[model samples]
Target: MTPDDDELTFGVEEEFFLVDAAGELVPRGPEVVDGTTERDGELQRELISSQVETATPVCRTSAALLDGLTSLRDDLARGAAARGLRLLASGTPVLPGSGHEITRKPRYHRMAEQFGAIARSSATCGCHVHVGVADRETAVRVSNHTRAWLPVLLAITANSPIDGGTVTGYRSWRHVLWSRWPSAGPPPMFVSLEHYENSVAAMLRSGAMMDRAMLYWDVRLSDKQPTLEFRIGDVAASAEEATLAAVLIRGLVRLALRDVAADRAPVSTPDEVLRANLWRAARDGLGGSCLHPESGELVPIWTVVDELVANLREPLGASGDLDFALDVLSRLRSTGGGADRQLAAYRRRERLTDVVDEQCV
Candidate 1:
């Protein structure tokens, strides 16, 4: 990879739920989003009135990413507090509530009307990381190379272990819930850019997807930007965790770009195997086993994580993020990541409120 490739800009978009003091979701997304002023990013409304989303400015360094995320989160938290609600970063709500209201946007209204229950029930939160690429063709080719690593990333960032006041048993219950959408899940391996566009055309013609924006695959070429967006993981429970995910994703993308330049063929893991591993990652997180991306054998999750990090060592080091990435990984290993931390908090008093209380900060 060229020096320029190592400096590809990236940005992160995080979605959060607004909750009252009792740990119940509240329909205050518009109030919180409008009330907050972002210094280096943008805060906007999500599909549900109970959710708010943040998009950081294009960032060229890990430090900038951390600052943007911290600033935006603080703004949202303060705004939510002013309205007597808390900005929660968990992937799913911890306590059961009546239901969430759809946002007032015309598009959202149509989604609610057309998608019905699926749209109404999708009050989930997730972290989407966007990395700059040369063009749509590059994004499609890089996506092929990066497909195997998506599940490994999900295993690391699984934070939605509880939903509706009960332990849902899956580390990322949001992933399972998100799969209800007809166009959601891992993207099919494409042979070329034309192949990718044809697939999208077919999905639209078949009514599986309403538009390009509904391409809810784990990784997809952005419809609005010249970048590849990774939508695999749940929204991380903290800024550090989110930053770790971004740096790791950028490294993977950089490595993929190099492979593309060299004309190296992408790994051809079977589509069924990719979907199965995704489910396994969402279920276990970092606590149990996952299928190795290369060998397709069930192994300790950390083993797969280590192998991924090792594979990206060169790209990460080239980008001057190796030390920071290692430090974050070390902390995650010690604290057991977001899902583990939330589980620990709940087990302390067997109170789901504790999980909400701990993650909100």
Candidate 2:
């Protein structure tokens, strides 16, 4: 790895759905990314016939991250309008059944053939936040301590409360849906990178996993990228919300690394409660209190969030990122998460699509 690879960095990838006029999901990929379809090539890539992915190049600062996201979404939206398509954000669109496969790429084809129905019907969108580390050791340390706090992050970014036209009664039904795969779910916190790699290697050897990416843990080190990728967080409605979650994650990592260096203990929850809290965060987001991922006690979600924000302030202050960190938390608390916005929109329009539409815009 080069010197550039040694520094910590952050980036994000988001997936979105393609819909057409009359509020219906459309399977139009060949026409979308071919450049002949009049679609903005910047933010849009044909994930399937009816889906696209938006990504921000690696960014070290909030302003740069925000710039990438803004350019991607805004340009994509304008392009969607020109093509008479509407962009919708949700883990999965509320529509039912069979979709199109416009991308004929071999990898996507193989994945579709392997997963079958769920793969073909998948309409999920998500915000994948990637944070860089010095090496595998730091990645493992960060990943281990990050386990207890994954639910907290999930709770705050629970934007996909609706799925298949219903509430789905989960903050991120996308997690539930994705977990069906043989290789997806939370990861165990190993004490070291060697342990982490060994565990994954064992799983791969068992024929249960296709590769490291298939591990599907809420937190995992990317095989392709030298970053600890946070696979939690429902894709947020606005770029601002995503920016908040991304920065907050960086703060947690920086703090966690400091603690680990000082011989502080790792935070881990019991498996049972961890599972339960994951469900609660999925079901309630911040509106309902989340069971403590570690202690199994009921904690007001926002209060816990506030305290976490406080806990990291010192280390973050030392780095001069405390202000942005606190500002993001304040916005999340005051403006509400994706779930909060969805419910509020539903109340106003008495419909879920309206909520989703508002989110994509």
Candidate 3:
């Protein structure tokens, strides 16, 4: 049986960069990962030596999710500090780094060998929120329903404005860098479960991806769990920002499940337009405009955010996250989201280290 909206469990996976006090990316991910105990969630190594990842335990309530993320972040921060390093949650590195080093894992080594430069330069960090679903078929259908909102979510959590010691002029430079992979970016509007599987098979056969695990669409069915994973947003600047993204994603998934149950067709946004909207979101973040998901008309980014909250009001309320979500949204509005805050810090001191310092927490 399908679970009730309030009963749908979700988990968040966040990737972080390890940097020295001067904000330079450092190859200390292994030390930090080994030192940090996974009390609330698992700590894992990433493709690059300077990055580590955390996955929260499945949580059924917004409060529980917040607590799990907060605890995990605290633990990871302490571990980094113990080794004279700091944990940074930004999507891209703020200051210049020595170079990328592929993790010693065999799978990571194989990826670097096969994909060459694409795999070598891909050290971007992102936040993935997995919302429980009944099955893979349901996950596929829900992905179609959830794809249109990805651009808005990306704009909300844009934190990687600086890259290689200079502002990239794009809000989410990580997204642009991440898109270089053949399997990355927004997933197509799948017609059915079979269609999704066939597409994956074709990509593997054509060498576009090495395996099913490389289906790095912004939204996809999880291969390791029974959930629909939303992989659009950056690793947010704080636990609260990360929690806000997870809550909003859960709301989106809940609403999609309702639409599926009602036999409502998912929005069939044109592929070209969807990709363009994503680029716009990455370029402007929340300070500029985005194309309305349905209307295709350019509107202030906050207008799209308002529409998103309005559409998810019932589901968010059913899941007991409406008030908390609203409060976070209000705070984001006042502080101007992650990218805005990062830019503000840089502009104040004209130092990328200041940007790094402000986000160290």
Candidate 4:
């Protein structure tokens, strides 16, 4: 592992949908990306023409992360408005049109051609947290160590309940849609770097994925960056929520690295157990049971989250993130995840436009 000062850094990537004056999905990604004033390569056009993405510079502190994320979000939103569209942070469009206009990029076009219907029908947006690692071996260890808790993170960040103009009955309908991809979800335990590389190479050779970047494991070693990319949760509704997710993820990675230094193997769970837990998280968010990572027993979601907070309290505090994490988790628990808020809006107005408007605001 590369030796350095005790500081660790992370970055955030968020994907959003574009909406028109009526809060309906609009295919204006090209316009927004072209016309955005602050074009520092932070803003990007995504797969769907109605979707856009933003990434933050690497940040060392939670406060910096929040500030950077908010600034980028505001700048990107303003750029969208200039194109006569609103930037929406929702995971799935409540009223997406029949057409799935693919972005005019060669890689995306090739993906659309190769994957056919799955590529065309997918418009799910998500938030990715990239936590820096010392090396590839460390990245593998951290990923294995952190896989069990991803479902808890998903429950906390559930933001897509409605998709295709219907309440899909899951808190994160985006997760369900994304799971249709060939290489999306929790990865199996990788005992060594050799095993990890070989597995990914085999997948590439099988044509299951186009390249290393398309590995799409919920958590994997990023090919282009020296970090572990966490692709577990939906795009958060607010900047604070996105930063909160990043903070918690950083804390988890720190804890995992500590375990690795102590020569401890990551707590292992069966693939079936992990998949079941992920499904439960998507279905119920914080409103139902969560599988206990240590015992393989079902417990109330609050219990699982509380235990996670307790376990990471010291690491978060040491990095000056504990207070912010506590505040965010408390508010999240009280108000429920974004999906709950969307449902509440839908119940009050009986209109998907209102739901979209609430998300945009």
TM-score quality measure for candidate 2: 0.89
Of the pair 2 and 4, which is ahead by lDDT?
Answer: 4
Please identify model 4 stretches exceeding 4 Å from their true place: 1-6, 39-41
TM-score of each: 0.98, 0.89, 0.98, 0.97
Question: What would the TM-score be for candidate 4 when compared with the true structure?
Answer: 0.97
The better-scoring model by TM-score among 1 and 2 is: 1
For candidate 3, report its TM-score. 0.98
After aligning candidate 3 to the native by TM-score, how far in Å is the CA of 122 from where it should be?
Answer: 1.0
lDDT of 2 by residue, 1-361 (tens): 2222223478888777777765567776445544432222245555467777777888877877877887777766666777998777777675544455636777667767766776675667778898887587878887777778777888887877766667777777877777676666677868788898898888889866765656777788888888889888777777877887888888778777777777787877765667777877777787778876556689888867877788877656654566876777677678777777777888897775677567766
lDDT of each: 0.90, 0.73, 0.90, 0.87
- What does the lDDT come to for candidate 2? 0.73
Tens digits of per-residue lDDT for model 3, 1-361: 2635477899999999999878888987987899888677999989899999999999999999999999999999999998898998899988886747998899899999999999989878999999988588888888999898889999999999998787899999999999999999999999889999999999999999988998999998888988888889999998998999998999888888888889899888888899999999999998899999989999999999999999989888998999998999999888898989999999997988899998886
Better of 3 and 4 by TM-score: 3
Candidate achieving higher lDDT, 2 or 3 = 3
Cα misplacement distance, residue 251 of candidate 1 (Å): 0.5
CA-only RMSD, every prediction: 1.2, 3.3, 1.0, 1.5
Superposed model 3: Cα runs more than 4 Å off:
1-3
Runs off by more than 4 Å, candidate 1: 1-4
Model 1, residue 56: distance off in Å is 0.1
Model 1 C-alpha lDDT per residue in residues 225-334, reported as the tens digit of each score: 78899999899999988999999999999888888889999998888999999999999999878888888889999998898889989989988998998999888888
